[model samples]
Each structure stands twice: as C-alpha cells, then as structure tokens.
Target: MSLTTEQITWLTKEQISWFTKKQTQTFTKEQISVFTKEQIQALIPQQITYFMETQIPYFNEKQIPWFTTEQIQALTIQQIQTFTKEQIHWLIYLQIQALTPTQISVFTSKQVLAIAEEQIPYFNKKQIKAFTPTQILTFTTKQISAFIEQQIKEFTPTQITYFNEKQIQTFTKTQIQALTKEQIKEFTPTQITYFNEKQIPWFTTEQIQALTIQQIQTFTKEQIHWLIYLQIQALTPTQISVFTSKQVLAIAEEQIPYFNKKQIKAFTPTQILTFTTKQISAFIEQQIKEFTPTQITYFNEKQIQTFTKTQIQALTKEQIKEFTPTQITYFNEKQIPWFTDWQIPYFNEKQIQAFTPTQIESFTEEQIKNSPQLLLRKEEIKSFNSKEINKYNLNNETLSSEIKNNSRKL
Candidate 1:
C-alpha cells in the first residue's frame, strides 16, 4: 500500500534512503510535496528516476539543488519536462552541465528562459543545436552573449532567425567576425540592422559579399563608413546600387577605385553628385567610361576639374554630349588636349563655344583637322595668329560668312 502524505512527511532522511525504486514510483504528488528537504536530499539517483511527472514539480527550490548530477541526468524525459521555471533556475552549475543533448532538446521555451545566464555557456554544441527556434528566442541577451565560438557555430540559420534585435546586438565584435559566410548570409535585413558600427567593419570580404541587396540597403551611413577596403570591394553591383546618397559619400577615397565599372555605374545621379573631388579622381579610365550621360552631368566643377587626362579622354561621345557649358569651362587647359579628335564633334555648338581662349589654343592641329564638325566662336578664332589659323586650315571668308549668318539667327 502507498504511504499516506502525513506518513511520508514523517519519514526520517535515513528512511527516505531506504525506499526501493518500486516504492518511490508509488509515491503520489501529495506524498512527494510533504517530504522535507532533508528527506528529498536522501533519495538516490535510482529513486529519482522513478519519480512521476506529477511529483517532480513539488520539489521546492531548497530541495531542487540537492539533486546530484547523476540524479539530474538519470531523470526520465517526462520528469525532466515537469521541471518548473523556478526549479530550472535553481539547478546548480553541475546539474545543468549534466543534462544530455536529448534532455536539453526537450526544454520548453520557458524552461530555456529560466536557465541561469552564468550556466548558459556550459551547454555543448550538440545541446546548442538541439534547441528549437522557439527555445532560442527565450534566451536573454546575457545568455546569448555567453555562448562561446563553438556554441555559436552550432546555431543553424533557421534557429538564428528567432533571435530578436536585442539578442543580435549583444554579439561581440569577435563573435561577429567569427560568423561563417553562409551564416552571415542568413541574417535577416532587420537582424543585420542591429549590428553596431564597431562590428560592421569586422565582417570578412566573403561575408560582405554574402549579404543580400536588402541587407546592404539596411546599413546606416555610420556603418557604411566603417567598412574596410576588402569589404567595400566585395559589394556586388546590385548591393552597390542600393547605397543611399549619404552612404556613397561615406566610402573612403582610397576605396573608390576598388569599385568595378558596373559597380561605379550602379550609383544613382544623386549618389553620383555626392562624390567628392578626391573620390572622382580615384576613378580609372574604365570606370569613367561607364558613367551614364546623366551621371556625367551630375559632376560638380571640382569633381569635373579633378579628372585625370586619361579619365577625361576615356569619356564616350554620349557622355561628352551631356556636359553643361559650365562644366566645359571647368576643365583646365591641360585637360583640353586630352579629348580625342573623334570625341570633339560630339560636343554641342554651345559646349565648343564655351571653351576659354587658352583651351581653344591648347587643341592640336591634328585635332582641329580631324574634327570637321567642331564649332569655334568668332572670338576663339581671333585668339589664334594668322600663321596658326592658316595651319589649322580655317577658310576665313567661308567661316566669317557662316559666323555672321549664325550671329544673325542668335
């Protein structure tokens, strides 16, 4: 016959130790609840395994920590599942470490949340992986940060998705750097937004490339400013296209050339306009050639003036055709001669007419000869001496008549 609750409560600690596993299995929840802490401590691992689910919750915090690691580990899954949040929190360090992956895997979200932050890191990788996303979400920021590198690697992308912004923000820079490319790619755009500026630059080049366009768009100007050289270079054209105008200005001058032609062309006109003169000068000839006419028109006077002869000469006719008259006058005398003979004709009459006298004189005779459609203002023609005008093959009478006729229309 089962012992009554009153009789069970009256048992001595020594008497509790004498009970067989068969006798332990017959104890009711009421009988278990009446046991003194001293009596509960006397139960062996074998007796503990036979405790019914209904009896396990009756163990008070004072009684719970008395469970030896062997007794804790030996508990049936049903008995383990019966642990109250308070009981889970009361478990000692050794008791937590004793849990098998199978036992850890069965923890309800509340049970996972009840784990003491100090004991979180004791879980092995297998135990870490065994947690469902629901359980993963229950981990406090302190508990999330307590994870070692090996434990962090065990988090699958699916499990990582459940981590709220606060949990993601608790990651150390070292932890951020330790993320594999695949793991880095899996962060949701919202999750990635929680990464602090200090952590942003620590991402490896491969990890940067692994970011989606949506993730790239989510970066703040502060985060964009901290991206290292290789990380900036790793951004794909699609990723580059999403950067805000403020973010574009955050790119360092030294990093500007690392952008490939397609990446350079990915900037919107507003973004293009934000490029500093130093950044514009960083563009290689190939990158210069990639700028759309609308993008070319967005360059400020300083930006236009900073272009090297090689970059200026590299601009396609379509790009040249879009230059404003103000932009044309911004080019220094040295830059004038770099324009190819073929490129000269694409300039509108207003553009050709806008060049300063020094700029007109800088043009080579071969350039004048090859560009039959090149338009020169009457004043620009007067800047050349007669011998030079003869050498340039200007038909003064015919040009004078045409100039007079053009002035009449104006």
Candidate 2:
C-alpha cells in the first residue's frame, strides 16, 4: 500500500506515531542497510512527524524538540500554517539561518501579523527587513500610521536615510496632520532635514495653533520672534510688541528721576516736551525737600541737561526759596553752580547791595552769563578773577573764541 502525496500530506499524528513505533520494532538490520543517506532522508519526514507527535509535549512548553534548519525548511505550507505561535517562533528561529528570499518574505509577514506582539522583538534583522510590499500594505491603517509617527522622532539617521520617498509619502494627509506639536518638536535635526528633503509637510497651521505654552516657550528665540512677527496678534501685544506702550510708560516713569544730561540728550525733543509740569514740579520738590546727598549728586550729573534753561531757572529759584538753610548749604557744597546762577536773576537791587563781596565772589561766570539773575548781579562781582570764574568763561564762550583766547594766553 504505497501512500499517495495527498495521503502523505494529510497524515495525522496518530498515523505518524504508530508507523514510527512499528518501524523501530520491526525493521531488521538488513532492511536498514539497503537505504543510502539520500534514501533515508526521503523517508525521514514520516519519522520526524512521528517524533514531533510522540516526543513533543504541548507547544508552549520549553521542552519542545528543536527542528534542524533543513527540517523546518521542508515543512509543507499546511504544516507551517497549523503551527502554534510558540512552534512558529521555534521555526522562525531555525529558518532565519537559511531561508531563501521568497520564504523569508512569506514567513516574516505572516509572523509579524500573527505572532504575539510580545514576540516581535525576537524577529531577526533580515526577517524584519524582508517584509514585502504586500505585507506592509496589509497592515491596518492605524498600525502603519503609528509607525510613521513614531519614526519621526525615534528613527536613527541611517533609518531615516534609508526610507524611500514613496514609502514616506504613503502616510495619509490625516496621519501626518495628526502629529502633536510636541511630537513635531521632538524631531531630530536630521529627521527635519529628511522631512524637508522629502518635501513632506508634516506640520499644519492647526497643529501650530495647538501648541501649549510650554511648547511655545521651547521654541528658539529667533523662531518665536519670527512667528510673532509674522502673526502679529498671535501673542499678547503688551509683552510681545517691540514698542509696547505699557513698557515704554513704565520705563519712562522709572527713569525720570534719574535722567542724566547724557540721557536727556538721548531723548527726542518730543520726549523732552512730553513730561507734564506736575512731573517737573514733583521732581524739583523732591530734590529740594527730600533727596539725599547721593541723589543730589546723581541729579546734578544726570538730570541737569534734561531741563530747558527756563525750567532750570524756575526749579532753582523755587528750591532756594523753599529749602532750609542747612539744605541750601548742602546743595551749594555739592557745587551745583546752576542753582546759584538761577538765584542771581531773582535778586533785587537791594538784595545785591545786601550781599557781602565774599557772597558775590562765590559765583561762576557761566552763572553770570546764562542766568538773568546772575547777569543782574554781575556788577556786584566785577572784580572776580578766580580760576573757577575764568574756566566757566572759557567753557561758556564759543569754541573758536576759547581756542583764540587760550592761544593768546599761551
């Protein structure tokens, strides 16, 4: 009774086991002697199946017999299909050593789709890479979509470089659009370059708009500023605007008391005119009544030029009249000659006549030249010839006149 191919194909575990037991008991030395290794190899499937049924226990047990690479390769499609996952894993382990391209293609796709997810990592490199186009296409849209999304951040440079443009473009618009701003942000510089080279538009305006505050903060300053500039109202105008009205007002208010001559010069004429009379009055009152010596020194150095001559004159006269004698002594000792000059114009003829020569001698020539009060009292100091007075004259005169006078003196 010779077995037909179909009968051999359909041989059950019971039939295979019974035959193996009977052969072991009944086959004589002379009968085995007639078979060469090739002849025995042809007969071995029956023996192999018999041992698999009788010797191997349940599939998941660790005690299962290891199949030779050649033996696994010889299994029929039906045998391969019927394998439990553990049995399949065993077969895959053996097959990886010697599988042909077609067999690898067939088995990798089947295992990837059918193997327990936990077993996925056990797949060999060649097996993983051998997945066919058809096998890749068979994945559920979500599964394939997730691979693309994860790859944007997780892929190594070599992996990104290896993906073909068509495979990259296979990601649907919705899939690409689904990435969060955070996910987009995690993309490596290499991945970003790859995306650009492939011309894949991974980020959409809605995705940009969806960025969290922390994500927004993570943007490079240039990137953030450019985005804000392009979308002007995208950020709060008070903090983001180049010329924020609030910031300007705050700086102006804070800086006013300390504004120096150089700083006053830096202000436009418009800024000069913008301060209210009340602010000027407040500053003058604060300086005369409350400012410390350190503050007065700062004001003399930094704030004097911020005032017009008329404003200075008014502030000085107000200070002299309102300040205590001790405060006036302190102010004079600070060498703020401007105050003394301003007070001169307000002196009556009787006040000038009342001044001692020492009091008149204390005045600088700039005080005499620029202050109407000082000019009116100048005759009282007519004999003044101090170096301090002359220096003031040199400084107040025209540059050419000072240069000519200095040359003549030399």
**Residue range 1-410, candidate 1, lDDT tens digits:** 37788888888888888888777767776776677867877878788887778778888777787777788888888888899999998988778778888899889888888888877877877777788777887888888888877778778877777788888888886677777777877888788888887677778787898888878877876788777777877888788887877778878776777787667777877788788888888887888888888888888888887989889889998999999977887888878878888887787876766665566678777776766534446343564567865676655444445455766665
Q: Which regions of candidate 1 deviate over 4 angstroms?
A: 1-22, 25-49, 52-78, 81-102, 105-110, 252-262, 265-380, 383-410
At residue 276, give the lDDT of candidate 1. Answer: 86
lDDT of the structure predicted as candidate 2: 0.42
Q: Could you tell me every candidate's TM-score relative to the true structure?
A: 0.65, 0.24
Candidate 2 local lDDT, 1-410, one digit each (tens)? 25443444454545544565455334443333333333334444445443233223233333222444565555544445455546555544444445444554665455545544334444454554555655554544344444533334333323333444344455566555655555555444333333331233344655545444344434442333233222322333222223222222333232344433333333332332344444444343333334322333333312343444444444544344433322332323224454544465654433333333344446677666755544544552443345645577633223224433454565
Q: Which regions of candidate 2 are displaced past 4 Å?
A: 1-65, 76-78, 82-86, 89-92, 95-98, 108-111, 137-410
Cα RMSD for predicted model 1? 7.5
How accurate locally, in lDDT, is each candidate? 0.78, 0.42
